[model samples]
Target: MIQTHRKKAGFQHAGLLLMLLPGVVFVFIFSYIPLYGILLAFKNYNYSMGIWGSPWAGLEHFRTFLTNPDFFRLMRNTLLLNIYSLLFYFPMPIVLAILLYEVRGRFFKRFVQTVSYVPHFLSTVAIVTLMGVLLSPESGIVNLILKSTGAEPIYFMAKPEWFRTLYIGSTIWQNAGFSAIIYLAALSSIDTEQYDAAYIDGASRLQRIRYISLPGIGPTIIIMLLLRLGDLLELGFEKAFLMQNPLTYDTSDVVSTYVYRVGLMGGEFSYATAVGIFNMVLSLILIGIFNQISRKASSVSLW
Candidate 1:
């Protein structure tokens, strides 16, 4: 009987491995295979010569990028943009989730959730285009309202100072509902007995939330934060690129967008590759640091 049970367990494990095989192969092909391209960072790539045939460029690409006049500007812009998002945009979803959990009416709750989530499904091009139409200086509703109120028309997208606000605000609007889903999932796992017991004990809503709900989700919050902090420098490339124009370039040019121009547009493949490697390394370091901090502070992390 024991032998039969062990054989059955072995078969179950084998089935699980079979289920996982496709995902492992997918990562190996799509993710691990791409590591070979990192070599382009150190080589002077040529179309005729191909990657393998390209001559070594040593650290010349890195040197040039470091010495460029725009180096500081690009670095500063990228760092600040992400930092600002971390500060302003990160907490929004948590707040949204908390509010949603407290929402009483089913219809209103569903309505709010649906409205918030719809933007997440919209394509970036569509969102940006809609933004353009809404913010158009000539005949947009915003300008019309301003004109009616006897205020001067403001070109939001054209102003460098407003770029960060626009970008971060749009991010909050677009992803807050989707981001809230994780927190909501965490909320569902909390024991309802705790809430019922707290209520019977005459605990106020705020006190219950503080003592029960927050503590229950504390580990989850820490894990999510660590995951986010790991990619501190990886701002959304497509949205940033779409939002960028001559006026907003000062604020909007990030590492990814600059890499696109260098590698694809400017044809400095080696230099672009170097920049990408730098970004990946920086992201790795930040993730490590945040993970360590999470482990130390809360004994919870994403290892």
Candidate 2:
């Protein structure tokens, strides 16, 4: 009987592994196989010689990036943009999830969720184009409204001061609802009997949320936060690149955009690769530090 049980367990495990096979193969192809390109960071990459045959530059590229006049500005913009997102945008999904969970009407809740998620599916280029049209100084609806109100038209996209605000605001609008899905799933897993017990004890809706819903999704929140931290330096290049103009580079320039300009446009492959490696190292260190803190404080971590 024991042998039969072991065989059954083995079959079940085999089935589970089979189900996971595609994802494993996909990561191996797309993620692990591309890791060899990191060698370009240490090499003086030559198009003719290729990555493997390129002359080794040791720490030359890293030193050049570190000593560049714009290094501080690049770091400042990247850090501030991500920090603002963490403070303002990170809580939006959690708040949305809790509010959605509290909605008793199924249809209305579904409608709201669908509407909120629509923006996430929109392409970044499309979103940036929409922003440009809406905020155009000459003929935009926004400027027309401002003119009617006796206010001057502001060139939002070109203004350095407005870059971070627009980026973070658009990010929240695009992603909050979709991100909330995880929290909603976590909330759904909480025992319904606990909620019933709280209600029977005369707990208010807010009280129930505070005591039950929040706690139920707390681990998911921590895990998501850690993941976000892991990508702290890894901002989306497309939207930032699309939204920014030369005038806004003071505030809009980030590591990713800089890499694109240097590597792709200027053909400084080795220098760009070094800068990217630095960004990756910082992100790994950040996630490691936060993971440790989370584990010590809440006994939850990514590791």
RMSD of each: 1.9, 2.2
Q: How does candidate 1 score on lDDT?
A: 0.88
Error of 2 at 284 (Å): 0.6
* Candidate 2 C-alpha error for residue 58, in Å: 0.4
State each model's CA lDDT, in order. Answer: 0.88, 0.94
Instruction: Give one clash count per candidate, in the order shown.
Output: 0, 0
Q: Quote each prediction's TM-score.
A: 0.94, 0.93
Q: Pick the candidate with the highest lDDT.
A: 2
Residue 296 CA error for candidate 2 (Å)? 0.5
Tens-digit per-residue lDDT, 1-303, candidate 2: 999999999998998899899999999999999889889999999999999899999999999999999999999999999999999999999999999999999999999999999999999999999999999999999999999999999999899999999999989999998988988999999999999999999999999999999999999999999998888888889999999989999999999999999999999988999999999999999999999999999999999
Error of 1 at 175 (Å): 0.5
Clashing pairs in 1: none
lDDT measured at residue 134 in model 1 versus the true structure, 0 to 100 = 87
